[model samples]
Target: MPTAIIAEDEDLLRSELRRMLAECWPELEVLAECEHGADALEAIERLQPDVAFLDIRMPGLSGLDVAHAVSGRCHAVFTTAYDQYAVEAFAAGALDYLLKPVAKARLEQAVTRLRERLRLSETAPDIGRLMAELDRRLRPQVETEQRIRWISASVGDTIKLFPIEQILFFESDEKYTRVVSGEDEAHVRKPLRELVAGLDPEQFWQIHRGVVVRAEAIARARRDELGRITVELRGRPERLKVSQAYAWRFKAM
Candidate 1:
């Protein structure tokens, strides 16, 4: 039986993919399920599964990063929530791309293609072109005028609006995100990923999978002897952990 691994950040989505796979490819053996890109990379290296289903956006090493590092060691199918630009890029590059909320028919089609490739002993797809396209799409483009100005969060039964200037950081908490400003904190139904899309990337930096801190509020970034990176925010007691994928942001500092 062919072995495969699924890498996705959202628990529900990961589980759903597993369920769909079981239904479509009953003979296929799922070797592992990973919640982040770092873990997914480790699993892929160790297991050397026949195929890997990678989510494009992840905490540490993103799916594209994993694919680039692996260098076509195993067949890869990318899952993305990117817009038309990325879709067009994937189509032009002839890369296997699955849209988020993966449809059963589409997955079945992917499975058929994988089976044929495996049966014929075909080489892995050329990921270099896909990586180049991804790099182009993911480049940080400034959107100065559209930055968020106010955040409305739920504080118990009442709703409170906090100006963007007063906010210090946003931390993911299960289904909701905790917005922190000075000594006050409130919860919002929005996830960190969605919030990051609207927030100015120059102003707010995502340090970890679940943490986004304001650039001006950050006092300093410290690295321990072990090479672990952490950021200390101004007037905040807690230090935020920085994932390896985003550590490049503090390279100069």
Candidate 2:
């Protein structure tokens, strides 16, 4: 039987994919499942499965990074929530990509393609060009107006607004995000994913799946004996854990 691995950050989505795969490709064996890019990379390297279903935007290495690193080694089907531009790029490259919420019909189509490629022993898609096109579409353009300027969070019973510059970090709570400034902290209804989309990427860095910190507020990044990177904010005693996928951002510093 063919072997496969699923890499997705969201637990529910990952489970859904597994369920769909069981129904669609009952003969295929799922070797492993990973929730972060780094873990997925490691699993891919160790298991070397026949196929990998990777989520494009994951905490740690990202599906693109994993696919690039393991080029030609396995059949890769990317899962993404990106727009039509990315989908067009995938189609142009003859790459297999599944849109989010992964409908049964679409997934069946992807599985059919996979079976054909495997049966004929086709080469992996040229991920280089596809990556370039994806980068061009996903990278933030020089539009200052699009950057979020102010953030409103609830401080007890009152709502307070803080300038974007004053904010030090945003950490995801159960259903809301906790906004922290120098000494003040407040909770907001906005999720981390939505906040990340509006925030300036250069100014704010997502160190972990649940954390986004201001670049200026970052005092230093340190790696432990195990080579796990963690960031310390300027005045904050808490050291934030950085996933391996995003460790490259702190490599220079």
Candidate 3:
């Protein structure tokens, strides 16, 4: 029986994939479920699983990096977002991949191919061509992605434009998104999800589903007795909750 490992950052997606894999390939024993690529790589190296399902974009090491490192040792099935350019790149390079919100039919096809590869005792294919293609196609978008330089939020009756650098953190309330900077705070009609795309990932990190904090503003992270981490800010009184999915960011290596 072929053993497998699952590596995805999101808890919900990882669980859904595990559940689906049981239904589609019951004989495929799952060795581990990892929250990040680093753990996935470590698990792969230690267990030597025959198949690995990896998410493309993760907190530390990317799925592509893990695949590159383990090219000849295991079979890789990439899980990526629904980007046409990335899909085209995967198709062009003949790499196996599943899109986010994976359909059962597509997953079954991927499973079939992997089973065939295992039957033939074939090693995983190298991904240089795919990486180069992704670098060419996605570089422009990543460069221009951080377009929100100034946040125009409402400060009571007056609308204030706060520089992106000035923001300490962003938290979503019931409806409005609260923008906090030191002692000052403002409300925005926009949701945190809509605002996340324009923020530079290097500068702002999504610690929680409803919380995004400026990296510089974080003083430290403290894990409580329950193993829950809350991030302390440099100047802010309120600490941010680090969700289980993102807890890998603060794990000590």
Candidate 4:
């Protein structure tokens, strides 16, 4: 049986797509339904679904952004309401898409193609080129201004700026998030959720709900006898717990 996840900001559209999938592809197990692109990306990494139905324009990471970030991982089926010019880009590419207010017949066609692709065990195509083109044409004035460059945190008596690149990991509680850098550590009022929006997905991976660690800082991952996994970091004594949901990152091949 195939597995999939749906991502659409609109409640009705998300539900409608799920209903349509059940109708057209009954055997397709929906691993998750995501209302935000960041959640969708995390779900894809965590669930390892066979297919992802992504909304082209999402709040934080757009569908194109997610597709590019997880290239060659899973098949992507974009759901778009782009102008005719942008729609033409999809038609000219190898990717599949369903227009907004997706018609049943079109979705059925997409389902059929997905089944065939899975049967053949086709490699997922890299969407870097398509994303660049689509991004350029869709949001010309938009740049990645949301990515955090610095974390201004208070030291003993003064505030210090930690470059986003040098940060090792972030652990959060209900009220505050702890920022650890190479030189020092500090606590801020922001939660992990809001900080995720500014952090680059490729740089910071959410190992646990309350923790986000730099991929480069990871030294090794060990699974205990109880089957729980923990991550050890370079030059750091603390071992971060990898939750079951994110344990897929260290799965044995």
Candidate 5:
């Protein structure tokens, strides 16, 4: 019997999927159900289930994020609603996908495919190219939804709301995003990726894996002694490294 785990944000959908799995695939044991990507990643790391039914989008980490974290640990069956890009990627990868409100017929088909692959003794499904394509198609959609308007931070017991425009940069350290405004900085609970979405791209540019700087605050770009490019912020000497992949963002600087 294959052990499976479900990772989804919505409680109703998670329960419904569990009920459907019980009715349709009785042999598969549901080892766990996670409500967010961070929790799901930890669960998958611990359980090491044979199948993971992951919702494509979630607050913390995406289903794809979980998949990337647990690469080759188990088969990934993505559950998404109206994400045609991910659906097509699943089809292309020869992996299974359960559309939201998971139709019985589709679920059955997915089970059949899973069984066939098991019988064939396939070691792992190749999902790299498929995931890349899905990211490409959904990047714009993700960016559109990542607008930061009101920011809530706290100095002590009292909370404060700072307009997004007041932020000069975002720095990631120890899994926390630190918002910087000139010399003043404050900590926020949101992760770097989450903060990136909430920020305006025209104003913020991710210059490094750990740093996203305000575009208007860029003072200049210069190559270091090691031939690596780094950016300096206006009126600030804190140099931020620019990865080659994201160097295009500072091309005009």
Candidate 6:
């Protein structure tokens, strides 16, 4: 029986996959399961599973990074929802990629492929070409309109949705992304990259990797003696740091 490990962040989806695997591929033994890339790496090193099911995107290290780290130790199957990355995965010569909300038929096909691979003594698939392809196309593409389709945010006991234009700035503090508007702030799950893709560049400038400030709300910009740049908002005393990458945007302030 081939040993395997599953690495994915979502709880319900992970449990569902476990159930499916147990039902469909009873001969395969699952050595471990992890919620993050870091944990997955540790598990792979310790258990040395024959295969790993990894989500392509995770909090700390990306799945691709982890796969590269554990090369030769185990075969890998990438699971992701985004279709654009499919081309890149193929270029990497990966074993297979299972799209999110995995279909039963697809899972069966993947199992068949895995069985065939184990029968043959082929090496793990090459993924460097795929990663390079991702590097070329993965940059954020700015959209023209300002809108918020769905929101994953908290407001007291209930989740709330405010239009994108209502947001003044996005501030990152520790683990959470705070959406500030007027005098209030709401916590949202969408990361800076996801948020930036939805926001219009003409209205929102990434003043710092940690911040996306509204273009109209910037009151002024000032530089400290040490050559550090800071921005002062209209009503907030807290100054936002301006990294060198975004220094050009502060010239107007």
Best by TM-score: 2
Candidate 6 residue-wise lDDT, 1-253, digit = tens: 7889999998888888888888879999998889988899899999988888888888766576576556546777888887445434443335778888898888887887677666554443765565445434532232244345444688779877766776788987677788887766788876775676566666777777679888888888898888678888888777889865456555544
lDDT of 4 by residue, 39-116 (tens): 998999999999999887788776765665576488788888853223322422324767788999989878877776
* Cα lDDT of model 1 by residue, 139-190, tens digit: 2232234557899987778989989889999999999999999978898998
In candidate 3, what are the lDDT values of residues 114-151, reduced to their tens digit? 67667545353765565555435433231244358888
Worst-scoring 10-residue span by lDDT in model 4:
85-94
What is the lDDT of every predicted structure here?
0.77, 0.78, 0.77, 0.78, 0.72, 0.73
Worst 10 residues of 2 by lDDT: 85-94
Tens-digit lDDT track for model 2 on 1-253?
Answer: 7889999999999999999999999999999999998898899889989889988888767676576556548877888887432422242232477879899988887787667556545344554654556435533232233568899877778989989999999999989999999978888998886787677666887777789999999988998899898898998888899876567676665
Q: What is the lDDT of residue 151 in candidate 5?
A: 74
Whose TM-score is higher: candidate 4's or candidate 5's?
4
Cα lDDT over the full model 1: 0.77
Off by over 4 Å in 5: 87-94, 122-253
* Superposed Cα deviation of residue 84, candidate 2 (Å): 11
* TM per candidate: 0.53, 0.56, 0.54, 0.54, 0.50, 0.49
Score residue 204 of candidate 1 by CA lDDT: 82
Instruction: Tell me the lDDT of candidate 4.
Output: 0.78
The lDDT of model 5 is 0.72
Q: What's model 1's lDDT at 28? A: 92
- Residue 209 in candidate 5, Cα distance off native in Å: 10
Q: Which stretches in model 6 have alpha-carbon errors above 4 Å?
A: 122-253
